[model samples]
Target: MKKSYRIKKDVEFQKVFKQGASFANRQLVIYYLHKNDQPHFRIGLSVSKKVGNAVERNQIKRYIRQAFTELQCEIKNEYDMIIIARKPVKACNYHEVRRSVEHLLFKTKLLNK
Candidate 1:
């Protein structure tokens, strides 16, 4: 994903968390804020150390990012989304992570039909 497509700032993430609507499944929690001026969606990822060691956390983040990359065209274009990995995600593979992400997006009605 491009740097421009990511939500990297602490304040941005907090704004999304505080003002956005959220949805979740067993593996992940998603918080989203609609941004009318945005031309494309931006995503923030959070994978805590409680989920695993540094390597494991990075792997989970990679999988989530890859999932977003693949689903970009199907996602709404004007939202800021934050994805927080749950502890159960440590045991999940890429496919599962992708499915969980897809599920959350669907639940939040952020995916195009």
Candidate 2:
């Protein structure tokens, strides 16, 4: 994903957490805030150390980014989103990760149906 499409700042993530609408499933939680000022979607992933060691956390984040990349075109634009992965997510493969992410996005109505 491009830099413009990734939410990179602490403040931005905080804003989403505080003001965005949220949804969740067993594996993931999604928080989204609509931004009429922007023309693209920005996403951030949160995988804590509780999920695993550095390697496992990085792997999960990579899978999430890949999933988000694939789903980007179908996602509604002009939103800032945060995806939080639970510890169980570390056990998931890419396909599982993608499915869980997609499921949460749909539940949140972030993906355009």
RMSD of each: 0.5, 0.8
lDDT of 2 by residue, 25-82 (tens): 8888899999999998999888888889999999999999999899988999989999
Separate clash counts for every candidate: 0, 0
Against the correct fold, how does model 2 do in TM-score? 0.96
Inter-residue clash pairs, candidate 1: none
lDDT of 2 at 39: 90
Worst 10 residues of 1 by lDDT: 104-113
Q: What Cα-based lDDT does every candidate model obtain?
A: 0.95, 0.90
Residue-by-residue lDDT tens digits, candidate 1, 30-107: 999999998999999999889999999999999999999999999999999999999999999999999999999998
| Number of the top-ranking candidate, with TM-score as the measure | 1
Q: What is the lDDT of candidate 1?
A: 0.95
